[model samples]
Target: MDFSALNKSAANSFNQQKSLIKKVLAGKKVKCNNCNTLISVHTGADSVMIKCEKDCTDIKLDAELLK
Candidate 1:
């Protein structure tokens, strides 16, 4: 019956993730753990992806993080 708590929790989660994304973007040391190469960030219509150029790692996140 109480949605306020749920909404606040969700908002907090989103904010945390967004902050992480910003850090990743601003960091120059971001690299693929598997291959030790630089990772690439790509944004699409509904999603964002962080991938290694050598195909060693791939991460997909919600596009809302970029907003």
Candidate 2:
């Protein structure tokens, strides 16, 4: 079975997610898929976090994405 295509697809998805995260970091509004509420992105000295007011979606991004 070919894995290159799968790898490429994964890479593309990752890039898209990173792009979205960057937009959030820049103060763009993003919504939570589960709760359909505004997502709040917070950046710290060493990490980035995203969450909704309802707490349905919470994710702590790797610090490397800050670049």
Candidate 3:
């Protein structure tokens, strides 16, 4: 199997995902530290889960960061 092609495909997917996420967050909202996507707000006990939209990676952000 050609690993180069696989790597290139993965890289292209990553780049596309990154660009899409960046375009969505171009308004300058708070970003998650783990995956670098815009932060999300949930309605529950915690009320907030900072996950990257592309990868769903979790990030621990401080409340003060919202300010």
Candidate 4:
């Protein structure tokens, strides 16, 4: 997604979310949607997919971070 249109506040929020995710995950495997558990991280990827632990829905990170 093109995030260039996001305002300064929104961009800041997005960055903050990314930072939080990095801190939380901390180089460990995470769960995915559709019951596929323990998905590993892809190195240097701009986007990361995180499954909702409570609802089992695939949430697209970085793009939705600014929304």
Candidate 5:
């Protein structure tokens, strides 16, 4: 195995996670619908997936429905 390559891959993964965390911190947040758990949100994203509490169900939110 190429240790250097593995380290580089890990570093890249770390950077991506760090960036996502920073983005989450900088973005808006709302409570999870079912559990009321606070979750970060990225409104402008294309939204591949938005989940709360790792591996848990995703909460769907609609402004109209909230009203």
Candidate 6:
């Protein structure tokens, strides 16, 4: 995965939402609503809604990292 782009996007999206990011990062686990996959919420931003590159169905947003 091109984390550079993800990180960039997350940073931009969470520019003013530092608290959100912190909350997400504080947790060790996160889940993908579309794929039901568990992802780790580490750095960058919280619940950064990203499009699924594998199968672009409906817009999949990260639910773990939200306000």
Clashes (candidate 4): 0
Give the TM-scores of the predictions, in the order they appear: 0.55, 0.55, 0.28, 0.30, 0.30, 0.26
lDDT of 4 by residue, 1-67 (tens): 5557567657766775465456445865545435655544332356656544544544366644434
Error of 4 at 13 (Å): 0.6
Report the C-alpha lDDT of model 5 over 1-67, residue by residue, as the tens digit.
9999999987876765455444454565644545766655434333333456642434333434323
- Ranking of models by lDDT: 2, 1, 3, 4, 5, 6
Write down the TM-score for model 3: 0.28
The RMSD (Cα, Å) of candidate 5 is 13.5
When summed lDDT is taken over every stretch of 10 residues in candidate 2, the lowest stretch is 15-24
Candidate 4: clashing pairs of residues: none
lDDT of 1 by residue, 4-37 (tens): 9999887877765455456667765576656888
lDDT of candidate 1 at residue 3, scale 0 to 100: 100
Error of 2 at 30 (Å): 1.2
**Superposed model 2: Cα runs more than 4 Å off:** 1-19
CA lDDT scores, all candidates in order = 0.71, 0.76, 0.53, 0.53, 0.52, 0.47
lDDT of 2 by residue, 1-67 (tens): 6799999887877776667666677788888767789888767788878778897666688888657
- Shift of residue 50 alpha carbon in model 5, Å: 12
Which structure among the candidates has the greatest lDDT?
Answer: 2
**Regions of candidate 5 where Cα sits further than 4 Å from its true position:** 1-8, 29-51, 55-67
Looking at candidate 4, the ten consecutive residues that score lowest on lDDT are: 36-45
Query: For residue 32, what is the lDDT in candidate 3?
Result: 53
The local distance difference test score of model 4 is 0.53
RMSD of each: 7.2, 4.5, 9.4, 9.1, 13.5, 10.9
